[model samples]
Target: MATLLELREEPHWSYSALNTYLNMCSLKFAFQYVYKAESERTAASLPFGRAFHIAATHHAQSVMQGKRMTLPELHDVFAQWFKLECAACTNLTFKNGESINSLTEQARFMLDALLARWIDWNNIVSVAHAFKVQVPGLGKPLVGEYDMVIKDGETTSIVDWKTSAARWSEGKAGRDFQATAFSFAYLLEEDHGMIPLFRFDVVTKTKNPSLENHYTQRTKDDLYRFQLLALAVERAVKQEVFLPAETSFCCGDCQFASACKEWHRSSAAKHICMAA
Candidate 1:
């Protein structure tokens, strides 16, 4: 099976992309996937979350191999990635006095909380496992990675790790489209009769970090609805119907803020004016 990076080379959709289109903004998606505009700067939180994710991936892989990392070791893992990510980032934007050092402290605290609540089950099936689902009527496939997959007794679960500044709200997991799409992908690709459980392990960022697990399940009807949504998004993308969600909360932190402001001016209009 091709890795997620390899799968990404071809035209495809993922939970993140769909979230950007549906929840974030469509013009942002067009700026990214269509116009291929480069972001002026990388947000500080973006790299911080990614570094934490990479560190968590390391921890999960170690657990799968039956050798969980110690707290200091895990902190070291996170620090290494955070430093590397920050160095590579161009024009890293920081807000509210956030710096590399501050984020590192937060990562340490979050990891400590995570290790304290670590479950001892070791029936690891896959870590950072990638999957590609082919939906009918769409030319492309939906490709993504399952952070971790494990079996406890007869029940199998797909686990995703997340680091957040605040605790997740009630029923947020149940409403997440990622869980729905991931559950749908697992069913189609694995051909499992039983619905695989979807779980999110979210760690909050604070002086005293906390870890919480939220579980969600998707049924056949949910999967059917998800497929229909995928088809609709695909149709919209094909028609080049991308538009800005001006009132979106995400606009404050949008990467394409500049491009969005200039969206009203088009090359076609410029050419027409010159001809006149």
Candidate 2:
């Protein structure tokens, strides 16, 4: 078995899934799952979710171009990630509860719940089939891995996981950008009444949906925010303007703390120093 370090170093990207995406990108940029391409186009314009990762890479590149992210800068860079991911960054800035640690914890908790929920997805989604796809045209494959690639009989999709709380929203039922990015990434196209739809199976774990509560799922407008958020992040990454954005909710319950020691300045001290 590959070590966690190895897995992180080389994620299980599905070439079958990614090949299909590059094919589309090279062949006039069409998607089977995108009803709204504008937002996704915008997100694709930059690297939103991985802002901190990019920033770290850039800095690392300044000294050591191909080096990996150090153990210390992970969380802050993760928090720095939200700087370009407009959705929750703005919300956290507005709500004043956006602690990097808090949001990170909530995201972690949500993913735990999502994994739990996914264990039962075959049940929640009555009938579905998963097919390994090979997108045409790209020089290289695109997907890191398909978490739960499936065709719901009713629609074609590549289900992905988002950890931020602001993404728990719905609107046009089956079309949201976070979901659309994957659709575009996978080159899904419109079929039947369903356009290329990206579903947000948000996992907020709690009997009652409260601020501090665990996880929840949705197909809502907040998902639209997800689209916007994704666009913003991608855009910012291209610009290389990943200045750290300090927000109230941006740094709550951050798990990268243990791994990201350089940012901590000392081994024993825990918690991020508020953005100065």
Candidate 3:
């Protein structure tokens, strides 16, 4: 019975958080556990993605509660969420000269396409389902809010929504840590030896929006890999090994880049003084 505030204060591991640690340990450690110096910045595509998820979750919940919404009503809901999200985010900017109005229109198109393809809402067992499971070999519980879980007799399907400009590949779905973790969590909860089908419903943000469904089934090996990853992350945290990872394209958007650079300069200066 952990409150949202308590969960935020507690140390927990998630797929995105662990990926952040792997991408740049110093940045993840500073942002997650230490004093966060930089303001959290919203990416340009986040508003649309958030709006899409909100709309989708609302629709799913309504259907699950035996009150399905019409397509037009869902579209209006998405529009309202998109408008509010755009107004709240002051730093959102598009590289392609796309304004908020234009993005909203594109999101509408995407929503329409998504609704057209997502006609199987009747199969959903849970929407925005929250779960906390103790992963083996990890100290803290892994918490996640799944988008949708569809149960068909003995078989189960996990649905994740994605709003992106490009369609996702099956290979990417297979390698996705979030999908692997969700499957593991679901298995732990059900204990049903059933391998759930993971589906990624991607809505593209193009002039003419498109919907792509990518499917992946997590094997025991995948779950083992995730467990190993979680164990390694826990060990790193205990050992205080938050070293800066090698520079990559992700460095361009890193919030801790300035602090990391300053620390490097100070270390180099100290070494020079000692050698002199």
Candidate 4:
């Protein structure tokens, strides 16, 4: 069992890296991971989600230790995280009509809504658990952190927290590649002999926030597909087949917009041969 820090000592893949390559844009992935390009701007949601996760981690850990944080106490935790993540950053881009104060208020409401939901913490196994697994066809190991792992009767669950602008569709979780990767990791690492449930506890950023629990599971076929995807991603990286996705939803606030523009100036082969 290698710690995430130890696993990060060498090259590896995570769900985020895979998602960026397969779903988002391959050119963006190359710019960020392969070329190590610096981001020109940061999305406001990045810090907001980080601050929210910090507070969520604190709350989950406190509850596991036999005490739950009061709403005021949780608010204080979020405030500190917000200040650290958002207040001091100059490159953060806010959406229309969004400001630091408004986002902070939204976080407060979101956290309140999270507290109002029913969270079963029966037999907390681990919080912020790090895992690494070697798939059959991939060269480097896959590494990721599980937000919460709990044992409920005969079942083990891996829970992740997410902040969304809108409610997720019912089947979003079932089709999520991250869930398949997580389930694969847990199956190999924990060896529970049963497929563990992967849950996304999502908090929405609305006038009145809402919490939705989306549960999804994976099978042997899903894990097989996950490995195949990883193998394909590795081959693409080796062959330098990165291509920009012009109509990607992430183009608005992309940090490497300038780099992407420069990439398009020359032919794809020319840029691929010489780093942009």
Candidate 5:
């Protein structure tokens, strides 16, 4: 198990970072390579997600260590973490008439649903486990933390917790690159020559919260495809080819939109001045 400090010292690529590069190269470059003048603000959903993960992992670890917490105790833990996070984050903005109280209630509902159905304490092998692995074609080591890993007899399973407004489709679970990467990382560590079942435990934040589970397994072919993708991303990053990909969906929510727009205006002005 690598310490957080040790992991930071090593060059590592994460699935989320790679996805950022694919989504918009300029934004990725700004975040990864360049230091921004100001710190990026957190989105409303981020703290909510973080608090839930903290509570879930805390419950899992405590149970594994022979200190089982009751559901109300778990809720108390969630509330404490959420309150701390909300207090620390200065730029949290609620959307569409969503207030802090409403979000807290939704979190409570989700927590109740999760405690009722998701956790099987006896089966969990590890929670929030960190790993770093080298893919054959990728330049940097791939690193990630598994939400939960379970060992049941001879079968191993990787469990990921998700909080969303809607349930993920079966097909999405089958094609998720992050889950596939987790499977590959696990296999690299274990060398068991067997694929582990990937499970996504989703909790929806609606008027009435609900829980859904989606399961899939990765094949050798999926790992090969990921290797190719990683190699392509490595090459692009090395070349410093950061191009802006403006889309209605991404541009609206992008934190670096203002930076990209400013860069474009300055570049246009430079071209005009040179021509004159």
Candidate 6:
């Protein structure tokens, strides 16, 4: 099957939706609080009212759906959607078994595509799903969410998912630092005990196999590149180096787009411009 980038050439969505997506990425990346460890990222402690904002968004999505579905429903039908079964859903359906048709069935499901990238059904002896590890000497640090913490007997790897119309193969620089941060959290906390292996997966959500859709797995060296890049960032953060990259991609979706674009890389990319 052809890759998604070569398939439709473009996936259609409202300008506002795309801009909102970009803005969410920017907000998390720019703010120090959201980047904090898992223990620090609760609904109550978020700075600049982001916690409230996130809660509200989920509430809004739930409101539209009429009710929440089970993990399987969320995983299969709408794991990647803004609604229960919208055509615009882009992420993976993780929960196994049959999907329930009803809208509101109580079950836990992580809604974020980037976070869901870590889930694996073929979990080996080394991989774990949603495992929590605490470091002994890391000053009570908050370990972030490791979507899939693989513990194949001896090797423990951190996995993450990326679900976008465009895959990471389209660009390597787009590797998320927040994802890397989650890996580090596990390393500092989880590795202190037994597992030492660490790997991140960027599974591009193409059409399903039976659906005649094909996707390319981004692994090995690709995942390592992000690991090293994020390492530098972690070091910089330790040194209080908070220099913003000032790129259009970072600021374009931001409320501060206009102010930041005065120095951004691409002037034209600063607005919520639709692509042809």
Where model 1 places Cα greater than 4 Å from the true spot, the runs are 267-276
Query: How much does each candidate deviate from the true structure in C-alpha RMSD?
Result: 3.1, 18.1, 3.7, 2.4, 3.5, 15.6
TM-score of each: 0.93, 0.31, 0.85, 0.93, 0.88, 0.37
Q: Which of the predicted structures, 5 or 6, would earn the higher TM-score when compared with the native? A: 5
Off by over 4 Å in 5: 4-6, 23-26, 32-40, 87-90, 266-276
Pairs in clash, predicted candidate 1: none
Off by over 4 Å in 6: 1-142, 170-180, 190-244, 258-276
Q: Report the C-alpha displacement of residue 32, candidate 4, in angstroms.
A: 0.9
**Model 3: CA > 4 A from native:** 1-9, 23-29, 66-68, 87-90, 190-193, 266-276
Could you give the candidate ranking by lDDT, starting with the highest? 4, 1, 5, 3, 2, 6
Q: On a 0 to 1 TM-score scale, where does candidate 1 land against the true structure?
A: 0.93
Q: Measured by TM-score, how close is model 5 to the native structure?
A: 0.88
Model 3 C-alpha lDDT versus the unseen true structure: 0.75
Error of 6 at 223 (Å): 14
**lDDT tens readout by residue for model 1, 1-276:** 888999999888888888788878888888888788888778888888888888888888888777889989999988999999998987889988889998898788899998999773577788889999886666788899998898989999999988887899999999899999898888878566566999999999877889999999998888888888878877878766677799999888888898888876966335445655
Decide which is better by TM-score, 3 or 5: 5
6-88: candidate 3 lDDT, tens digit per residue: 55566777666777676556444655565555634556677778888999999888888878777788878888988898778
Candidate 3 TM-score, C-alpha based: 0.85
Q: Which segments of candidate 4 are over 4 A away from where they belong? A: 1-3, 87-90, 266-268, 271-276
Per-residue C-alpha lDDT of model 6 across residues 220-275, encoded as one tens digit per residue: 45445544544444443344333344554534333333333342353323322322
What is the RMSD of candidate 6? Answer: 15.6
